[model samples]
Target chain A: MIKKILILSIVLSTFMVAKTPKEIYEKNCVECHATLPSSLEKMFMSYIKTYSGERDTKIAIKTFLKKPDLDTSVMSEVFLDKFGVKKPTKLNDKELDSAIEYYFNQYKIKGRLN
Target chain B: MLVSRSKDINLFRQSEKVSLIRFLVLYTILVASLLLLISIFYYQSQEKLMYAQYTKLLNTYANSQIKKLKNLHHYFPQQTRYPRSTKFKSAIYDSEESRIFSLLEKEPQYFDNKIYRTDGKIHLVHTLDTYYLGAKYLIIEVDEDRTWLENTLKYILILGAIAFVILSIFGVFFVKLFLKPMRDAILLLDDFIKDTTHELNTPISAILNNIEMIDTSQMSEKNKKRLTRIDIASKSVSLLYQDLTYFALGHKMQKKDEEIDIKALILNRMEYFFAIGNSKNIEFILNLEEVYLFIDKAKITRVIDNLVSNAIKYNKRNGTITIDLTPMGFSVKDSGIGIPKDKIESMFDRYSRFNNTEGGFGIGLHLVKSIVVEYGFAIKVQSSLDVGTQIYVDFRSKGYTL
Candidate 1:
């Protein structure tokens, strides 16, 4: 009876803890982007920092994700032909705001690559 | 002699009441219709604005998620589909419009509009530029919560009801204010008629009484004929005076409802009207039944008097008049100059005479119609050009139909 109750508690808690946006980012975004401070995602953010302001860069990231095609393409044509454009998003307002905030903080180049 | 037409002062207040109700009904319809039209237009614009705001919010949410998907696919070259979102339900479709994977149980019914609504929920289907996870159509569904709209509609209806009541009250006040002049004019007419009727009563009685008392035993036969002519003319004037008197003071007079001997009343009216018909060389054929009616005596007498007067005044020389009274009702058929078919309906309008050939005030039938309506009696007039006229009054009333 005790073991059954313990199992039930674990199941209930699992349902109770709805994934936060930061958690969602780590699970969904970090698999290919990697967790290091020198991933390709970080490199792209550094390049975006050179030409775009902080809010513009963040907004650009969101706009490109929403509609990725030849017209809004940042990658070369060769790469575009190989990988194609990204699909549309399914995040609600609460989840999307949290995810964007996570992306802004994670890949931001605050220090030198020494 | 009576100075003017047979205009009843007692009916002035009744006419005012009728006009007051008419003005109120017409004014209310105009105000309410305008208010309702404006409200409907406002509600439609408000609905459009609300939907636009909702769509903008959904687009912002979708755009953020798309960014996250792009980041995931950039570094990971072998990725197919990203992790599913837990916050809201959505579905994705390929370029062929086939569903890839959805949090929904089934595919959506249509993809025609950028925004679609289904049972108590809003659905936004946005086209994607790129095929991340091989998706072309991105659909997001949210539960509809329109308590604000419902509240707005409720407020509008409440305000409309209050406005309607307030406007109606003001309308009545203004209509009454506007009709004050008309009422004063009618009052002046009544006062004049009353004064004239009072002054003429003494002279009329004097002329009639002294004529009755004059010694005609030793008078010349030619002078006797002249006196007889005067008597006939005076009696005709007396009938007109009596009709006017009843119109003026009849309401003030006490009325008692009793079982009236209708046959006796007809016989007396015929004898009294004998001089009138004889003067015109018109003949009266009365087929009166011994029917007893339970009503006011003065009103019945006025009705019969008006019908007989009309028959005599409008008749040709040596023409015939047929008055038939049965258990059902009575009819006055005249063998005289006929009324036009189109003018028959206008016979009951006060001072409405088709031809001015005869001397009359034209209020006889108007008074008849008023009494018939009061008792819920059905009246019909049938006439043809150059043929004759017949007026039928059906006394069997269920109630006032109008």
Candidate 2:
């Protein structure tokens, strides 16, 4: 009876530990983009505004998130001097896409609702 | 010192009996380790190659698209048919050259193409690499399906696994087949030892019997002495025959463990040895305790015949041979050229001999030892080099009950 109970507990623990795709995204990158809602137009606008003067935003963001780099951040020297350089968020491609869409809808076009 | 070939040959790390098993186990481990190492290397290198190929194909698509896009701008700069072109599922056009194109071939909707916002639509584009040139990025408006490189890697791994398993099974079978001849040779050698011991009984009997029938009364004194020596040679042959027979065929002998009068059995064996003893001028001093033992008469006869013949053959001329039989056991002592100190231990070993002068194949004491051992009796031999030799056979105390 004790052996059966132990085996059941082990199997239950594994299921509990398993993460869904949404949870994986939330844990890895939700800190930065969790407040944003999902929208493709808003996402594109947010990307433009976020890296206003950046040379290569798509390639830079993809490479940077996979392997972070402070030297390539699109934030201006004046913004970084005030806020201190924002840390680049780490995420898998799938999770990053979800977060990216969320940021676009929330910050980029939140004013367009009116 | 005995030189053993088994000790000298250290080709393998174990004895002959277990060498093949050990070799099989080692070979299995080696093959498994090699397979594991190769699989790991192949997995790592193949994964890298696949990724590189994917990147290369994607790059090829991007480069070809850029080349065509440049040519189109050169030829028809104002053509709004760019979006309708089949080169890209969805394409964004910049005023000068900036464009993001998505390939239509993908299983699930994941990626999108977008031209970044810049001052006056500055035509800045980036190229990517992939394993398949036909498909790179997918467009949201177009849906296509064909992933060739991923399917290729999957097939390669599956086929490699099947080939490895089949080859490993064949290797195990071949190893077993290769070891079969050596195993058969050892079995044949054991059979040869048994057969050779069985073939020695016939001629040995004929020689001993002819010597017994010799009459020395008509011969001269020198000839009579030679006859006596011949008699000793014959008894030695008889002893050897008894030992070999006891070793090979003793176990199959019928046993009748009746109450045997030990004194009478000793006296009968003494009579058998008298002819050889007479030729040697050896005197017999019988000291019988009239004891009884429980044993088969035929086996007891073999044991007594071997011991008495030994005493007579090694006895000096005119020497006294004594036989003392009791419930405890029997003892035969002779004043003759006694066994060498070094040879006493091996006296019970088959074909172990100390004296070259005495005619003996050296199987007598070996036979005596075997009979005593079979009946749970103990025999001890004691000798002084020039004095005499004494052999004592002690049947265990339980022999008295029967």
Candidate 3:
């Protein structure tokens, strides 16, 4: 009976997982950044768009986000002035990269915007 | 003063007393020296023991205080207060005076089995030497605690003094006790001399009288020879009697320091000994200087009598006796059996004799030695066995010019 219940749970959880990049971002992110402010979000969207067009989009976005220098930072001076410093995203390097990938594919001009 | 007077009695004044005293003196010196050394060592050791005990007491006090402070530290590591006990007063320090602690409510004193100045309360502080956790952080002061040592020393000194007094008493007692036998011996000897001299007095006179009364005209040649032998025997006894008297009383002879004609005295004594000298067929050769000396007459006569008679007695048959008297000294030389070298030193000891054949009781040289020493004179003997003996009496040549 325990084996049959475990098999049922594994199969049900696989269907709930995001199958594409858009779904990955929708499922994992959106809570902190979506409501933060438009200016900050727009800056973050630009960095995603710029790095997402590259052939090695995962590597480029992952390195940039993990240790963001002032030159590579996506946040504007206005937003930084309002909030004196941005808290570091707690997601690991690979997780943040994957999330960024999912966000880029969902919002890309070519992809579905919803 | 009375001791000095008694000490002044010479052995010559009474020879028996002198010998007894000499023996006692030697014994006392030896015993006193031994006791004095032993007593000093004993007293010093006692004094040292007292000091050692005093030091031990101080150490005990320090150890007890240290132990208490360690306990206090265990209970109250940061407590700056310490309880004051009647038994001790203490001071504590911690970390170079970063913290100083005391446990005395007031000064502490232990006197006459009572504690004083205790403040009737406890004092508290916290100080410690963290560098050495075992250091004495507390020192307890006991007023006049050192009195234990001082009293010990005082009692030791008193004991030493008592011991010294006791030993001194013993020394005196033993000295007198040890001399008792010698004293008794002297008294017995004196009684014997008194009785024997009295007994000899009668016989000597009787022999002389009988010799003189014998009619030699009617007797034969054999009878004359017998009479001469009796005469010689009488003279020998007379000489013996004179010597015994000299030995017994001669030391007390006064130093009259009279102007003495040395040459005349020698001739007179030589004449007295001529008969004995002739009996031994001994010839005399005299070379006398007209010298005078300042000395006791009786002592010089005794010295002369001993030397001349000994020469005659020990002379060879028809041997020569030479008497040479000068301003410097006089020598009596005899051609007879010479003294053995080993016996020469003891020759002057009373009754020390080398010749068993000689009729002397051996007091002759001993008497000569005593008289010579009394007058600050020196006598040297030179001898070879079966050859001869020479006695040189070196008078104070410079002092005896008179």
Per-prediction DockQ, in order? 0.02, 0.02, 0.01
**Candidate 3 chain B, poorest ten consecutive residues by summed lDDT:** B1-10
Q: Which digits, one per residue and each the tens of the lDDT, describe model 1 over residues A12-39?
A: 9976888887787777556645743345
Please give me the DockQ of candidate 3 compared with the native complex. 0.01
TM-score of chain A of 3: 0.53
The number of clashing residue pairs in model 3 is 10
Better of 1 and 2 by TM-score: 1
The candidate, 1 or 3, that scores higher on DockQ is 1
What tens digits encode model 2's per-residue C-alpha lDDT throughout B1-402?
111122122233234538667766777677667766776677667555644554454444456665554443333323313323453333322222232333223322222322221222211123223211112232222222124335645655686577667766876686657766765565465345345545545565666677667776778999977877776666655656555555544544566677788788777766667877888788999989878777777678878887888787788899998888766778899998888888889889878878878766776777777767878888888899879999998876445433
Candidate with best lDDT:
1
Ranking, lDDT, top scorer first: 1, 3, 2
What is the alpha-carbon lDDT for the whole of candidate 3?
0.64
lDDT: worst 10-residue window of model 1 chain A: A105-114
Best-to-worst order by TM-score is: 1, 3, 2
Candidate 1: which pairs clash?
Answer: A65-B66, A86-B132, A87-B132
Each candidate: chain B TM-score: 0.72, 0.49, 0.66
